[model samples]
Structure formats: structure tokens, C-alpha cells
Target: MKTLGLALALAVAMPSFAAPPVPLNTTDVDALVAKPAKGTRIIALWALDCAYCEQNLKALADWQRKHADVDLVFVATDPMSQSVTLEARLKAAHVDTVPSRAYAESTPDRINFLIDPAWGGETPRTMVIKSDGTRRALSGALTTARISKLLD
Candidate 1:
């Protein structure tokens, strides 16, 4: 009886895990970017296979901690089949609690083209979309200074 009670207590004490990633297609991505709202919205693209992506996620997570009011969205480039691994990575970066989506398509090239034809499917790609829908794209691992500038 004590063991059973302890198990229940542990379960209740644990932090709630994030929900599974939703299907993200070209139309969905377009809708997300086009959605109108105040302030700047950050759309970060990353993958579990990319080392630089991990760094970028950690930087973004730290920046997010200080700027809770800023809107941020994460898009995992890995296929939906890798959602478990993706979730674990996000948790490690402390950004799993944020709004996140994963690629539903099997073909990464298609997803890349839809996001930005100019982009060559780079990991750690970040897009900052302003309230007016103007955007700035940054590619490569994010630094603290870069994050501060983007947020400011």
C-alpha cells in the first residue's frame, strides 16, 4: 500500500509533458506565418540531427525565459516519426513547454521549399516576423547578443 501511494505521488509531482507534435504542411506553415497579431513572433526551425540546432534552441530558450511576453514558435524539421526524439531534445533545451510543431511530410525538400525557396534547408534557421508581417531571417546557431538584438 505504501508503494502504491508513493507511485501515485511521484506521478502527480512530475511536470506535465508536452503534447505530441501536430502535422505541419505547406498550407499550415503559410497560415502560421500569415496569422496576424501584435508584437514580433519568432519562428525557429531546427532538427535533432543538427548540433548547431541544439545550441540555437538553448539560446532561444534562455532568451524566452527573460522575455515571456514575446511570442515564439518552434518547427522541427524532422519527420513526425521522430517526434519522441524531438520532444526529448526540446525538453533538454527547456523549450518543450513552448508552442511547437513538427514536420508531417516525409520529404524534407518539399518542406524546405515551402518555407523559403532561397533557404537550402539549413538547421537553426530563425525568422522574426513583426506585427506588420515584415520578417528577417537568420541562419546559423544563435548567440546571446543576436537574440537580444532580435528581441529588441
Candidate 2:
């Protein structure tokens, strides 16, 4: 079927990063937002237990393939000790090609607060920040339309 071919092609196009994630502290996030490295940075916050995170990652990775200016950064909110699981999950999604991070500190609540006080410790939270100090966020499994809206 045509859908099967498309799926196979997407799988081939996306390769696993398979590398361990770097440690992520609040300071690191603050510094990145203060000076984004690319035209737009999309920070995806996910956890090992979140069922929808992989789907979001795969979709976002596909979108990134089409948009050269969009940078996708993934952060596992789980503790750094779970790097093995993090790496495995990211590999499964084929989003290991991009830079990834794991929560370095143990205080998840505080880290989440530092990332965004408005957020309520939700999984699969996505933050889209632009170079001009403007940003938007959406939590939950993102739809193509919602992802597009975040950029606009």
C-alpha cells in the first residue's frame, strides 16, 4: 500500500542517534534561551514513562527534515541515571541524531519550574523559542496543525 511505503521511507530517513544524553541543568536551559543557536529552537521535554513522547519525537523529527531553520532539542526530564532508558527510547524514535539532554539534578519539580513556571510537570511538553526572545509552548501529543501554529 502507499501508506506502507511512506512509512518505510520515513523509517529509513530517520536514523538513531544512539548516544548518551548530556546532563541538563536549569542554567543550561537559561543560557540557551538567552541566546538561541539557530533561527528557532524547539525544546521537547519528555519522560521515560510518557506514552506519547516517542510519537511526538518522530513527528517532530519528520517535520525538522523539511524545515532547515528549525532546530529540535530533546530533554528527558527523568534523572540522568536513566540515561540508558532515555537513549533506548530516543533510538527507537530515530531522533537520537539531534542533541539530547537528561535532567542532571534530582529535584524534578524545581527543574520543571525553572524551565517554565506555568508548566505543571506535564510530559511531552514542547517549547518553541525564536531568536528574537519570543516563544510558544504546547503540551501533549502535537498535531501537524498545532505544530505549525506554534511557529506562526
Candidate 3:
């Protein structure tokens, strides 16, 4: 009877867990990138499984809090993970603040316009987007020094 009661309690409590993040497709992603005002600049793209992504996500969040004018959008290579597994990992890591979106398989170029084929679907790939639609793409984990250099 006690075991059954415990099981029931666990089941009841599971619903309190955070719901998975909403998956945003290619068109939806473009809209997000386009939403910024005339002068909006962005740090875009990252995978959920990457350590560098974890650091960058946290740093970007902190940076955004200080520089509210800048925007950050994390793009996941694996779209399906965004809704459940990614959400859980992000939550577990206490990474909040950076808004995340999934890359649509149908439009790979539009999703990660900057990654080279050598990256092998790695995370922590990053891009800097200017208001004029110009972009600078970087591959590999983001370090503080690398981010500073890129921004400069």
C-alpha cells in the first residue's frame, strides 16, 4: 500500500515539471531574426548538448541583462530535441534567459547560414548578425576571448 501511494504521489508531482520549450520552425526562426528594430545586433546559433554552448548561453544571458539592446537566439541543430530533452537539460543546468529555437531541416542554409561542412553538426557554432543582414560565422566552442574578438 505504501509503495502504491508513493507511486501515485510521484505521478502527481511529475506534472509540476516544466513543459518542454516550443519548437520554432524555419519561417518562425526568420520572423524572430527579423523582429528586431532597425539597429538590432545578435549572437545567434548554438546546440543544446555543447559545453561551450552552456557557457555562451550563460554569458549571453548575463550580457543581455547588462546590454538589453543586444539580442540572442539559440538555434538547435536537432529540432526534435528542443521540445523535450533540450528543455530538460537547459533547466537542469539553470540556464535561463536565452530564447531558443529549432533549425528546420527543410531549410538548412537559412537555419545555420554560417557553419562549414567540417563542423560535423557540432554545437557552440556561432554567428554574429548585423542589422543589414550581413553575418559572421564561427565554428567551435565559444570562449570569452573568442567572443570578445568577434564582437570587436
The lDDT for every candidate, in the order shown, is 0.81, 0.85, 0.61
lDDT by residue (tens digit), candidate 1, 64-121: 7787566888899988888888888888777787788899877888878777777788
Which 10 residues in a row give candidate 3 its minimum summed lDDT? 111-120
Q: Write the per-residue lDDT of candidate 2 for residues 1-152, one digit (tens) a residue.
A: 99999999999997544569999887786864553765888888999999899988888888889999988888889999999988988877768887899999878888888788789989999998888878888999988888999889
Residue 141 of model 1, lDDT score: 77
Score candidate 3 by lDDT. Answer: 0.61
TM-score per candidate, chains pooled:
0.83, 0.85, 0.65
The RMSD (Cα, Å) of candidate 2 is 6.5
- How many backbone clashes are present in model 3? 0
Best by TM-score: 2
In model 1, the clashing pairs are none
Residue 99 lDDT (model 3):
68
Q: Which regions of candidate 1 fall more than 4 Å away from where they truly are?
A: 1-13
Q: Pick the lDDT winner.
A: 2
After best superposition, candidate 2 residue 86: deviation in angstroms?
A: 0.6
